[model samples]
Target: MGPAQKPNVCRQLSRRALGFFSRDAGVVQRTNLGILRALVCQESTKFKNVWTTHSKSPIAYERGRIYFDNYRCCVSSVASEPRKLYEMPKCSKSEKIEDALLWECPVGEILPNPSDYKSSLIALTAHNWLFRISATTGKVLEKIYLASYCKFRYLSWDTPQEVIAVKSAQNKGSVLARQAGIQQPVLLYLAVFHVLPFSLIGILEINKKIFGNVTDATLSHGILIVMYSSGLVRLYSFQAITEQFMQQKLDLGCACRWGGTAGTVGEAPFGIPCNIKITDTPPLLFEVSSLENAFQIGGHPWHYIITPNKKKQKGVFHICALKDNSLNENLPTVTASGRVVKRTFNLLDDDPEQETFKIVDYEDELGLLSVVAVTQIDAEGKAHLDFHCNEYGTLLKSIPLVESWDVTYSHEVYFDRDLVLHIEQKPSRVFSCYVYQMVCDPGEEETTNRSCEKETNLNIILNSDNHSSDC
Candidate 1:
């Protein structure tokens, strides 16, 4: 059979989960053959609306159509669809690719750069490479390759720092290694790179053996907060990391052990840039930094410490804001140096099913806070989503989600100050995006606004050609 005739599990699972698969064995084989025939007949690949918002206007990629809101299109005067706006790397026959079977389209995010020239500066990531592309002229500004076989995580564009932080790890072949009882090496690496000119500023091989494997990483202020598998959390200075590389003290090949026991780097804990172990609890998931308060010493940022409500507060998130002052050596106990806020989230009063809920995404604007919480689907396969005020803990809207036609929490929710976008992948391998415009009450000072209007809806379909198969 040809490469296009392969039986893919992703497509098969999507079909089976949606109950679109045929039961007859002969019919299924014939259907697969028909799909392969269609793949062979196609000449070129076409991508549907891959969109990103800029200010109030949302730009549809590939087609280059812009939508101001749900009612009107930006350049609606033209009769036909807009032409392709950007160009991406294409595969050639002469190229001997290492990961021919396992590949994904580069996921792009529009960076928030306050510049006149950068109207289209976007960060794109594939398997183990990051690309800086210009959406205006379809030009690739810079490309950096991480490792041959690795999975990416903790990817964020830090606007203030003007750098993009990405965490990668060695993907030991199959993703089912742990389930198959195969031991894989603990290899997690964090790389911070320049966004504009696209240079590799700093690279650090996280010491998984000493600090345990990294569960997640986040960028707050100029600090890189890393959480490990053992539930131990540490902080490192982003400025210091790039400075080391700029001064030629650390190389790309050198593995820096920044957070071991005392004297690991021949410096006192206070002398080191960021050498604080904030937590020892194993299952705590680190969230974003909530508030920043300035005092006599300096301004310190407080981040949310999130733990699943599995114990005492079931079906709730035991979230608390904590300020870590472990950088000061005068503080004897690092964990005790943390100042935690007493607030927690138990939004629902009568959730008897003990459904798992999480603060998937959130935004704060003009003394008003908004959060999107996703609860696990019930016995009828209905997922519950709550959008509300984080401070008041009052539910603004409870949206029931099903699999067939509506949006799913399986995807991430992207938001700005006034809009929230829900992008989900359908069983047909298409992406459906729903954008919501938020409106606040001008009369009420204490009560948070709960009214929201549907702004726009977009669907993205990937058309596969012979060169690049289904993405």
Candidate 2:
């Protein structure tokens, strides 16, 4: 086999159809389906309407709260007057507004699955009935007391999926159940966004550059409450869809007891991905975690790689731990790479607080990147991610995180290598760039005693910084 072409041994690099997805040079696994769903659900619904009964037609017509099912927003109404669903007299086809009611949501309960993000919230309506319904799964999950004259709403303001939802209480009556596990069969309300706190919107708009990609609130299958203040935003994520929806519903009289006056009605309803086309087979996924602000919070972002392969490993997610007090470095040693990137923070002799620390991103070549984080789930099974930039911090690199593109309806696979290997910058170039991901498994070290030498064949792979505790 001379220097001739051979049979392709790797996945073919995509040869796009010229004007494919996003206009940008990068990619966009476009999921028009999701966008379509959003168009129909999130934006079509009137901000204050939540009824679709024939009887409510007169009122709906008055409120500008109606649309053709075709508009098919990903969110649906919560609860309304009984005659409301039937109040509106059926109109002729010519009178339709929204486009596709893909499939009418069955009469049932919506169970939410609160991911790490607080995209959804549920509330009760007037008359003490389970009026407001919002969740990821619009299908029936549990049963509610028909006698409960309370209504609920899901808020969506700070999310990407549908909205940052919050549950509210309309009329008065029995407060929400706080039992360990109660079931309520319900309907799924996809997106909702009540009035959002000015603080949040202010923070986002002010720091758009860094948080351009920060987690936006979205409609989720779970219950979440976002606490954004004091530079910390805490999310109370519920495991089950109905876990906490009822826990935070408002009191009677519509006087919001949650905290603020921010509240809104349904946006859209979620749909089952067209089961017809999607195969039961799953796509390869990668899971990785990186800090929002590694070297700089609103600074240069980071990048990871997912090579074409099986495991779908993830590249390094570099993170830096910065504390209020600077670190005092030990006498720094110049590595074989000719550059001196220190590890141990040395302190100035006289003043302990005023110590020497690395001014990350000070060099022209070294820009800011992502960061590593450690989440220690508390005894209550609450995983508290260290969002602080103080004290000792761990810079971790994880692998195998997966993200889907709702913009593109196509499903694909992603695989990356576990970050741990590095390429030693040789005398080859003046400023040789060494690219690699590092794996830091501190818990496994004492028992495994694994040496980098045993893991690699490249002499450059086993450099000094590639030690068990360092890189």
Candidate 3:
């Protein structure tokens, strides 16, 4: 492979590859068909032929449907078996799809089922419109316009009385008069909508002062958890909104019990005010005086508040169980106020230079938390990665990866099944993905321990990130 012969060699390889696939022979046909079924061939303008290229877009899997975006501005779905279903048109000629989510109502835990509602729906939010499409047919079932007042930052699906969750992004802004002490206005508004009719139920304007800036909000098991930038979390009752949607007919005479306007037959319905004030003062979950603003909330049922202590450079993970709602199973319960300190722990204390570590991203699957962290950098301009496994502080496996300074990583975790998929790419436009089946059974410990040695060989395979050019 001399420099001068490289181009000629690649040209020959490409022709042979095409000729091999173009064959109509028995073996060739079977091989080609099997490959096609194993992976999708996506066409994009950036690359002339993306048949063999792996997409960098996020892959979403729900109820057997696999959703991903083709760089050409189309969001498409297929079965997990890699069969194409539908490719939605760009949100508009000018706008690309911002986000797409698949949600099933009657997610029987958070809210009761609506009388008229039946199955799940695909939510595609683009520009200023939210389109509810049928999951099976990929046809637009309904379209709802998000008003100018409520900026849609994220969309979360609640478990109806059947359950799943999805995410979307939406925004809010106001004109500010410049002055010495003037600050740009920031507000958190909760917009409720009827999923079946695809109409706005109401928009609840939350007081900004209540909790500095809303960092994240999620609705689960009928309780709405709001996290703030200051590490303050507040729980609000979603019953008010759930109760109204359950009714077969609208109650216009029912004034908002939360001090908002009412909902009409048409327009934003605020008829049943959210009883956000379930208590005179809602229970405050956390008040980290020394906490910086880089925290994230994860975990189901029990909320895992993860943040790094900049001073120590170690990550702090706080686990708070949702308030015991066993007695009041009607709505999601909030964790009592005094349990934050007792439940908190340091993520990885054994690492010598844990302070230099950064928690890039993590996923909880197969009863273990897979945390991808960039270990302390070495002097050779190369970096290492440690897949820190934490079953709530009990470390399971810490697999170290090959040293590489500037590699990009994308991953997908399947909740329905116990499988982890990771794609790593280097600056040379080379990509490699690995599917690791998480085996944590005590009976399989002997076999699993032997597999750890093979991980070193896998890391060596990753070193050859450079690939031969197809053209």
lDDT of prediction 2: 0.23
lDDT of each: 0.39, 0.23, 0.40
RMSD (Å) per prediction: 21.4, 27.7, 16.6
Candidate 2 on 1-471: residue-level lDDT in tens?
112232231212232344445665334333332232222222222111111111111111111112212121122122121111211223344332221111122224342433312222232222222222223433222212222112333333334332333333322222463253432312122222222111110000111132122232222333332222122222223333222222343222222222332322111121111111111222212122223211122223332321222232232223332222122235346544344455544344653223222112111111112222222223211111111111222222122111111211211111111111111112322111111222233333322322332223222221223432111
lDDT of 3 by residue, 1-471 (tens): 111111233444565587855455766655543333122111110101001123344434455454444211222221111234445554443344455555555434454434324344445344444555666556666555443444354555565522323332323333454445454333455555555534444444444455446765666655566666564555556665444333333333332333234343322433233222221234444433224544344456644344444456545534443353122122333323222224345565665344343334443222334455554444322332333323233343443333333323433323222333444454444443333333333343234333344433333332233422210
Q: Candidate 3 versus the native: TM-score?
A: 0.47
RMSD of 1: 21.4
Best by lDDT: 3
Q: Rank the candidates by TM-score, best first.
A: 3, 1, 2
TM-score of each: 0.43, 0.18, 0.47
Minimum summed lDDT over a 10-residue window in model 1 is located at: 450-459
